[model samples]
Target: MNVKPPSNAIPTTATAHAFEFSQVTSSAGEAWIDKNLGASQVATSSTDPASYGDLYQWDRPADEHQKRRTATITTLAVNTTPSHADFITATGPEGPYDWTIPNIGDVDDALHSAFFARTDGSGVCPTGFNVLTECN
Candidate 1:
């Protein structure tokens, strides 16, 4: 059947190197990835290296920025996709601490939400999978 993921998800082939995907189903009926964000294989335990996949910004696309050796930056992106793969670190105290922090006067919350919510909404998520978000 056509089970869609709940919310918050991972990308498919959008990462620096072609990422791999495996489908998994939850007890609650939500669909999901078989591995972690950067993992190529399923994890065997909590401390498995496969458990800790790539380390990119949580807000950006799977665009190579989260590579193990990726560069980190302080400058924010002005658009949906960033030109560089550097992980965008948080700026100063007046915190717009997410990579989705837009240029001043640009206030579209969907920037990050879209990517994290539905893969088709606006992100790199695979065909029928998404990361899970908390429900209130």
Candidate 2:
């Protein structure tokens, strides 16, 4: 899923820490948010702070770590299900950083899943809603 890093991904994510899921549905059965997750308002521009919402680690759960002001921990999780809520920072352009990515995988591979084999979006997305698959 080398998604072209859509600029719309953020503006599509605000408000309320983005914990609210599946609040709206399209006629084609597509779900979307009126506001970016964790954002205070819908995005007006790339510099709109309110629309920045919270930063989510790929596949990470909608927990405290998603908060914009959450503390950062320089440690990477040993497993997919991290028990804590600290924003894990990338180890620069050196080594693996996040959980959803493979240690030796491509930097552009948005769908890289070395340890992540599940496609159900469990633990990350709210129940009844799932992270968009590559085919979506």
Candidate 3:
């Protein structure tokens, strides 16, 4: 499951082999990382904003194509504080992904504050959008 931020909150995503691409777009690449890999574990910068790429645990693989890239990280809980929260992966004139959104649920309550529609136009939840149930 992907961990999506609240509609009121900013959007964040998982990191990928950004530089590997012929031409890298800092914000676009990082947004993909935040949405897919989860938030970064280190400090963020323009080059590594939100530190999305660093979130994964890349290990050499037997396959050459995957060898250069590290393994994906899959051991994170849905408990990040607002101050240190790095979920907002993309912003401004850098990314194509939308961050401010809301998922569908018949029940409207404070707990459902974070749930949002997975995609911009799709009524259904996005394939990997993570649901945030509780906010402390």
lDDT of 1 by residue, 1-136 (tens): 1224545543333332355755656796555566666676777887887667776454567777877778888876766478878888757433656665545333555445555666563444555455454452
- In lDDT terms, which candidate is top? 1
For model 2, give the RMSD to the true fold.
Answer: 7.6
Taking the candidates one at a time, how many backbone clashes does each contain? 4, 10, 24
Q: Which ten residues in a row have the lowest lDDT in candidate 2?
A: 1-10
Per-candidate TM-scores read 0.66, 0.53, 0.18
The residue-level lDDT of candidate 2 at 25 comes to 47
Candidate-wise lDDT, in order: 0.58, 0.51, 0.29
Candidate 3 runs further than 4 Å off: 1-43, 46-125
How are the candidates ranked when ordered by lDDT, highest leading? 1, 2, 3
Per-residue lDDT of model 2, residues 6-81, tens digit only: 2223224322323542244458645555555456666799898877766667655666887878888776676445
Task: Return the TM-score for candidate 3, rounded to 2 decimals.
Answer: 0.18
lDDT of 3 by residue, 1-136 (tens): 2334333433333222232211112544322213223223343555654445323111111122222243322223222212222233333232333222223222243333333333331211233333333333
